[model samples]
Target: MRDLLAITKAIADESRLRAVGLLDGRELCLCQIVEVLGLAPSTVSRHMAILGQARLVESRKQGRWAYFRLTEDDAPAEVHDALAMVLASLKRDKQAKADQKTLKAVLKIEPEELCRRQSDCKC
Candidate 1:
């Protein structure tokens, strides 16, 4: 029950949902997600942490970088079902479409470059 509640709460936010959408299948470095969402690294990290606690996503550390991907193979049935529902529901959303487009461009930038750009931002 606690896990179920956490999963629902984790996905309640728009930004977190979008992050989940971006991570639907592929693994992405922290910087890539940061760039796609245009959010501070700390903010995105917090979002990912919530998703992690829900067992909706998993993270790995490689050197100084962290990468995240959907928790497919071992995710509980509820988490899997919730992910499917969210993905299907957002497939045609306007903001999701824009995020997808931006993600394409964000992916083109090397992870290091993305991290550098993010660190240099004054906003």
Candidate 2:
């Protein structure tokens, strides 16, 4: 029950949902997520933390960069089910399609350059 509650809450917001959608099949640097969501790094960090707590995602730090990906098959059944539902629902969403396009552009930029650009932001 607690796990279910956490998963539901983690995905309740639009930003978080889009974050999950963005992570469907690939790992992403924190900066990539920030660029796609157009949210502050701190904000996206918090959102990813919540998703992590729900076991809906996994993360690791490589050097100074943080990367996040959807949980794998070894995750608990509840998590797998939740992820399947979320991904299926997002499949036809207009915003999710737009995000995919934006993510493509973001991915074209090198991760280091992306981080540097983000650091240069006034926000």
Number of the top lDDT candidate: 2
State model 2's lDDT: 0.92
Badly placed stretches (over 4 Å) of model 1 are 120-123
Cα RMSD to the true fold for all candidates: 2.5, 2.2
TM-score of 1: 0.94
- lDDT of candidate 2 over 21-64, digit per residue (tens): 99988999999999999988888999999999999999998888
- How many clashing residue pairs are found in candidate 1? 0
lDDT of 1: 0.88
Taken over the whole model, the C-alpha lDDT of each candidate is 0.88, 0.92
lDDT of 1 by residue, 1-123 (tens): 987999999989999999999997799998988898889999999999999999999999888889999997788899999889989988978888888899999888888888778874322
Error in Å for residue 84 of model 2:
0.5
